[model samples]
Target: MAVLPVCQDCCQIVTVNKNGKIETHSPEPYGERACNASGLLTGRVRDIVVSSALRAHAVRRSRPTTSWGPVRVHKSGLLPRMPDAAPDAMPAPKWLPHLKGGTLASVTLPAAGWLGVWLPGYAKPTQAYRVEALTQRNVTSAWSARMECWTVNNQHFLSVANALMRRHEKILVGREYNPREKCTSSCKAARGPLCTCSCHAKHHGGGRWMAGWCVAEEFGTVVDGSRWHWMITGKA
Candidate 1:
C-alpha cells in the first residue's frame, strides 16, 4: 500500500512501486490519501468487504425484532409461566377480570337452583379461620370443604398472551371450577368439602360481591360484600 505525493501547485499525484519504479502518475491528485492497494475501491479486498457487509445485513433481517427490546428465547414449560408485575400496581388489565390466587371461602348453592359457587379470598386461605378478621366472627366452622387444599399456595398475580396460540380459544382455557384455596378450619363434611353458607354468609353487602361463573357459561355466585376477598373464577 502506498500514498503518493501530490504536486502542491497542480494537485497531481505520483505513485511509485517498491522498486522505486513509477507505477501511477496522476494529473489530478486526490485531496486525501489513497486507500490500501486492492482495498476500499476494487479487487478481492473490496469483494470481501462487501460480502461481510451483506452478511451482517442478512442477519439483521433474519432475526425477530421488537421495539420493546431484544427477543427472549427460552424452552417452554408444560404449564405456562405467568406474567410478572409489581405489587399493588393495579392498572386496569389490558384484558379484564383481574385474577389472583386466593383462599376458598365457601362452596355454596346460595339459592334453590343455582350451580354450586366457590368463594375464594384474596388472602391465601389459612387454617387460622378464627383469626379475629372481624368479618366471619361467630357461629364457628371456618373451613367447610377440605377439597385438595394445596399447602403450596398458588401464584399471587400474573399475565399471559405472549407466545399464545394465534387462535383465541386455545390460549385462554380453564380447568374445573374448584380452585381449592387453602382452608385450615376443622369443619369435616363427608361430601368433598361441599356445604351451605352459615357464618360468613351475611357479611357486608355479601350479595353484591358474588360474581363467579361456571365452565358451562352458568352464572355461578351473586353475592358481593363478603369481606374476606374477591378474585376471578377459573385460574388462567
Candidate 2:
C-alpha cells in the first residue's frame, strides 16, 4: 500500500499507487456533511501537485541563507539585521537641546570629551563650521575618516549642535514648498518647485531629507555591528 497524504484544507486523501496512478477519496460524513466530494482526475491532480512542489522548491532556493537562518528579501534588498547594543563604555547620551526639536543633525559622545556629529553628507557647510568652530576655540577637532563624522571635544559640542540645528531650520524655511503642500506634476518632472513632504521626498527626489533617531551603537560608539537609520534621500 502506498502512503497517502490528506488534504488538510478539505480533508480528502490523495495518493499515488504503485502503478503510478493518482487517486483521491472523500472520507465519511462528519456532522451533517461528508468530506468535500469534489475531485480531480489523475493527470490534473498530478499537474497541480507537481506545480505546487516546484513553486515551493523555487521559493526555498531563492531565499538567502545565513548561518543563523534564511532571510527574506525586500524590495530595497535583503532585510537588514538588528543593530547591536551599545557597549557599557559608551552609552547613548541625551540629544542636545537644539536637536530635541526634531532636526536632522545629531550628536553622539563616543568617548569622554569627544563628540560625533552625523551629517547628511561629507563636506557640507555644517560639517565645515563644526570643524571651524572647534578650531577657532583652540580645541581639538577633525573629520574622522574612519567614523565618517566630525569628532570634536565636548567644549564645543553644544555650539556645533546648536549651529547645525539653526542652519538646518534655515534651509528648511528657505524652501518654497512646505511639507503640507501637494506635490505637482512639475515636481514629478523635476522642472518646477519641489515639495519637502515625506511622500515627495521618497518618490520624486524633490529634496534632501533625513528622519528617524539613531541609538549610540548605530553611530561610532560600537562601530562593528551598527546600522544607520533609514535615510529618505534614497542612499540608504
Candidate 3:
C-alpha cells in the first residue's frame, strides 16, 4: 500500500509510496473545510490544481503538471513534486592483531587506536574473522597497497586468491555506488548525476530535487571500493 501524505496549500492528499509512485488525491470542496498537511514526511514540493468541483476529489501524478484544466498550483510550496559517511584514509593498522577466527561472535572494533588488520584474503578485518572492528589511525605503519580491497559498511578480510573469498566479497558488497555523506542544503551541487563531489541523498534524485550530489569517476573506471562515495559519473 502507498503512504498518502496530506498537503496544506490546496488541501490535497499526496502520497509517495514505497513502490516509487507519487500522486495526489481528491480534495473536499474549496471553502468546505480546512486543508492543512502541516507536518508530513513527503518529497520537496508539488503544485496541484482543482479542475472541477466534480473531479476535485480525483487523483493525479507527476507529469508536466504545468498545464491542467482549471486546476492550478495557486501556492508554490504546495506543489507535490516527485523524486526520491566518509572515513579516514590510511592503511590498515599493524598491531590491530591477526585473529584467524577465535571467539569471533560479534562484529565490533577491538581497539580504538590506529590498527592494521590482516584477517586473510582482504586487508579488512570482518572478512578474516567472524568478529570485526578494525579502524585506521596509525600514520606510521606505512601505507599498504590496495590489492583486492573491498570496503563497505564493514571490512572483510577474505583472501582474494581464494575463490570463496572473491565470490563472497562480490555478493556482500558488490555494489557500484558507494555512500559517503549526506547532502545538506549548504552543499554546492546541482541536481543530477553531474555532481562530482561524491555527494548522495537518501532518495534517487535527492531530497532536494533541484540539487544533485553524486560524482563518479570520469573515465568509467572501477574505483577503489573505499573511494566508492567519490565515484559518481564518467567525466567529460
Q: lDDT of candidate 3 vs native?
A: 0.28
Residue 23, candidate 1: alpha-carbon lDDT: 29
Total clashing pairs in model 1 = 12
lDDT of each: 0.23, 0.35, 0.28
Instruction: Please state the error at residue 11 of candidate 1 in Å.
Output: 80
Q: Is candidate 1 or candidate 3 better by lDDT?
A: 3
Locate the minimum summed-lDDT window of 10 residues in model 2: 168-177
- Candidate 1 has an lDDT of 0.23
Candidate 3 per-residue C-alpha lDDT over 109-206 given as tens digits, one digit per residue, 9 for 90 to 100: 11122212232222233343321223233212222343322232222212211222221111111122334455555454344322223343224344
* After superposition, candidate 2 runs with Cα above 4 Å error: 1-103, 122-126, 133-136, 170-236
**Model 1 per-residue lDDT at 193:** 18
Q: Tell me which of candidates 2 and 3 scores higher on TM-score.
A: 2
Model 3, which residues run further than 4 Å from truth? 1-142, 145-183, 186-204, 207-236
Clashing pairs in model 2, backbone N/Cα/C closer than 3 A: none
Q: What's model 1's lDDT at 27?
A: 20
Clash tally for model 3:
32
